[model samples]
Target: MREYLADISRETEVWTADVPTHMIHFNGDRFLGPHS
Candidate 1:
């Protein structure tokens, strides 16, 4: 069910790099802003 999938997603550990310190510079000069 959707609730079960949601629970699994919530409990999962997703690995990602920490937000870079210069991301603001990159955002201004490169990519768009972060999204929801």
Candidate 2:
């Protein structure tokens, strides 16, 4: 999946968690990064 994402766009951000689950956020009007 990482390779595919990278191929799409270099600006794409890829993050992986210790668990099997993951999340992604695209350009939006609001903040998409992790929050407190």
lDDT of each: 0.35, 0.51
Task: Please give the range of 10 consecutive residues that has the lowest summed lDDT in model 2.
Answer: 23-32
Error of 1 at 13 (Å): 0.6
Clashes of each: 0, 0
Q: Which candidate comes out best when scored by TM-score?
A: 2
Q: Please give the lDDT score for candidate 2.
A: 0.51
Write out the backbone clash pairs for model 1.
none
Off by over 4 Å in 1: 1-8, 19-36
Taking every candidate in turn, the Cα RMSD to the unseen true structure, in Å, is 12.3, 5.0
Q: lDDT at 34 for candidate 1?
A: 64
Q: Write the per-residue lDDT of candidate 2 for residues 1-36, one digit (tens) a residue.
A: 554564556655554456546545444323555665
lDDT of residue 36 for candidate 1: 44
